[model samples]
Target: MAPTIHCVRHAQGVHNLCTANHVIPDPLLTDLGHEQCAKLREVFPYHDKIDLVTASPLRRTIYTALESFEPVFQAHPEFKLIALPDLQETSDVPCDTGSEPQALQQEFAGKNVDLDMVHEGWNSKTGRYAPINSALRERARAARRWLKARPEKEIVMVTHGGFLHYFTEDWEDHSQYQGTGWSNTEFRSYTFSDEDHNADLEGHAVDGDNATLVETAESRQRRGKVGPTPDRAQQKTLYQLGTQSWNQQLSTEEQDSAKVPEGEEVNGVRV
Candidate 1:
């Protein structure tokens, strides 16, 4: 069976404070952020069952994973926090980009966090890590494939809110003009969909492999009663709108400076 994925958006960071803080390069978690992690640590029920813990290389995400899953690490010393470069935030803003591997290693020295998967140019907003729509889609696909191939039965991932939408391929509540609806430290559980259907919405297929993720019933129950679920047609429309929004944002950024606009209202909070 494929591993059950617990996707968590990083807790509040310094950049989440105000628009001005968005320029802080690789900002750390706020005091509330740490408290949120503590709360998650208390409520998270799979500490003993978790076989792997992964997170984006960004400071906030790394800290979130370490703090929120401290019990898991304590119980299983063999598992180190895997830093996945492909799980980095979708944007190239200063707050979203990660620090150099050396700096991260020095900061997290004794924390049992592994930076081996983070490449030299992982933080750069060029090439595969570009903020454009196509690059992000491909990265999301690769990340899904990697997770599906893992041997672990239960896994945890701490990543940004914007990228979470892409990773899950569910844009039900996504918005291009504003930030994501995912709350700070909020977590959703998912299981890989069956591979009977080989092609994705984009017609991408790999040896009849299906990388779609289906949210577990427990996760939905945690969210309480919500509105009616959108149909397949609605989902595809939302996905296309999300892709177009990303491309439009990329074009605007290319014409202007790499920095966000003065108001600093990004697609996702602090992204």
Candidate 2:
């Protein structure tokens, strides 16, 4: 059977509590973020079905996975929980920086997660250059290949919001309502294909391409209203969750100018 991937974005990190544009390297979850993770544990419907749990090496993501899925881990020792450095967020921004693997093992302490598989400097950032965008795209594709190779029928990954966009490559502005990208602690399930993964590896640019996602029937049922555009209230909520706030020092005109066009997307995948 084809594997089903449950992609989850970490709950609000310490950086999220700030107004905007301020960067804090590899911060942990805020109190509210922890609360969100706890709520996720209560509401998540896939605990029994998930056979594998993977998390980005980032602190926030690791915490989210531990808080939300530790029960599943305890209940099913046969299920594996592995940390993947390649799954880190797709930005060179300070907030996206990750800690070393050894530090992460010490941080988790008695947790059941496996930190042995991580490579050295797996958390290092590529410099802020024009080509880094393409490199991140390829990294996303490579990570997809890695995940698909796993033998588990159902897998769960706790990662960052920015990278989840590239992971799905559904860069549509319409994707917000389509369950393409994610909100805090949100989980969306997708089915992967070797053919689609190969297309991305064989020179298809994630920026221009619409990578078709095969969402599970359960995923579709759980998704919000389906539409070309989100309603006004939904739009406000999305703007708050999906992008950085404009600098308060800037004039309204400057902020408007900085905003992407209403019908267009800013990040690869987001409204």
Candidate 3:
């Protein structure tokens, strides 16, 4: 099997939270914010396998990485840092970009006038709780390319808490509410492999055994990677169904709504 790819959300920031009143803004992790990441740095195989390093375009995530990955750079100065916009926090907290604060709850479709009960239907720009699924999948696809170029090796992504929360919790089934919020410092791995021969220069296979797999808890725990995974099958399944329903509704909405011209450009970027 190819090495495992680990996705870590940065430790809690001062601004790291969901708002009961409205969308959270500008809170960053405290001194202990990056402390968990710092401790994690001592455990993972950053020195052994990690071939690529990327982060969300957010400071919390970036700062968390600086502390955790000090050893990685000292060993490989040539490794470059890439910032992915898609991997950024979705609630639209504006920092210096001057955009107004986009409430995380308002992001959902049917936000009750009351602050607490956010509906899955009316939750995001995409109107899906699992937009993070799209983001994570894109990262995986990008991983295929990175692996092809680097040759069979692990790729580590240092990212945000919400993204990791959705990925491990609701991804396979699609759920609106994230099952669990992430701990300040958590290391989760999703492994990818290729079975088909249309292999890239790096070695990704296309067909058999080509599908990605998750490593076992025993294996991971044995390695002293991290912990706290209880059996979460039922909750995950229910959320998955809800996610599927919302996606179907969104598809219908898109079909009904008139779209811009195929050739149309918005700010030098096409829709």
Candidate 4:
């Protein structure tokens, strides 16, 4: 079966060169960002299986998708890059509030979408549609099921960090959600996964690390970790659980390290 879509965020861009009200920043990836993409390719050595690539239309996301995957896709028969407007960053609020008018608002505006807490106010008091995100998620869930229907393929989507963290469901908050994006050349491949694969990982905290978590449908419905798992900060990195390419390259160590089998998938998460 194919993995759910990869859903990656774009590389870093100039945060302060310029900013303006209603203006989006058009920064490119930085040197450090390039290094990070290289690290991503090395860590996920089996990147050629991606059947398709998609991205938000923003320059950072488009450039990131092209720079990171072109090497792997050169030999791919069905690979092509597409765009999804739904994956764009949260709309920038206007500059009507004169909080910081030292200069043009353009310089500092890009920073707003960097990395903030996930949108929790689904039903804000304003009764107006709160962008504490919802529709984006509904669309992604639909997208995930649609992709999984295809067999033997992987999908890559490069977008902004906000969509990656707050909207993409399979991640289970496993994403580092660090303030910065990958270096211009660096990229990471996230397995589009179902909740069942992680049933064994829940309530299983590694040291003070409350952030790195997994979930299954039944348990997630019953004992949702209300906000942070309410623990001390411990160190942990994102780790893969499974993939077709991974199975082929399964060293004894890797076979042993995988958290679950290939057939397992959370039906509740399946549309």
Q: All candidates' TM-scores?
A: 0.87, 0.73, 0.53, 0.47
Candidate 1 residue 264 Cα shift, in angstroms, is 12
Question: Best candidate per lDDT, number?
Answer: 1
Evaluated against the true structure, the overall lDDT of model 4 is 0.41
Candidate order by decreasing TM-score: 1, 2, 3, 4
User: Please, what are the lDDT tens digits per residue for candidate 2 over residues 156-236?
Assistant: 989876677666654434245212347678888888633432244234445422333455567756875353333334443
lDDT of every predicted structure (CA atoms): 0.80, 0.66, 0.46, 0.41
lDDT of 1 by residue, 25-47 (tens): 89999988999899999999889
What TM-score does candidate 1 reach?
Answer: 0.87
RMSD of 3: 14.4
Among these predictions, the greatest TM-score belongs to: 1
lDDT of 2: 0.66
TM-score (C-alpha) between model 3 and the true structure: 0.53
Per-residue lDDT for 82 in model 2?
Answer: 89
lDDT, residue 185, candidate 2: 89
Write one digit per residue (lDDT tens) for candidate 4, span 22-92: 23334556665565466555655447667667665455666677667766556763455654444555333
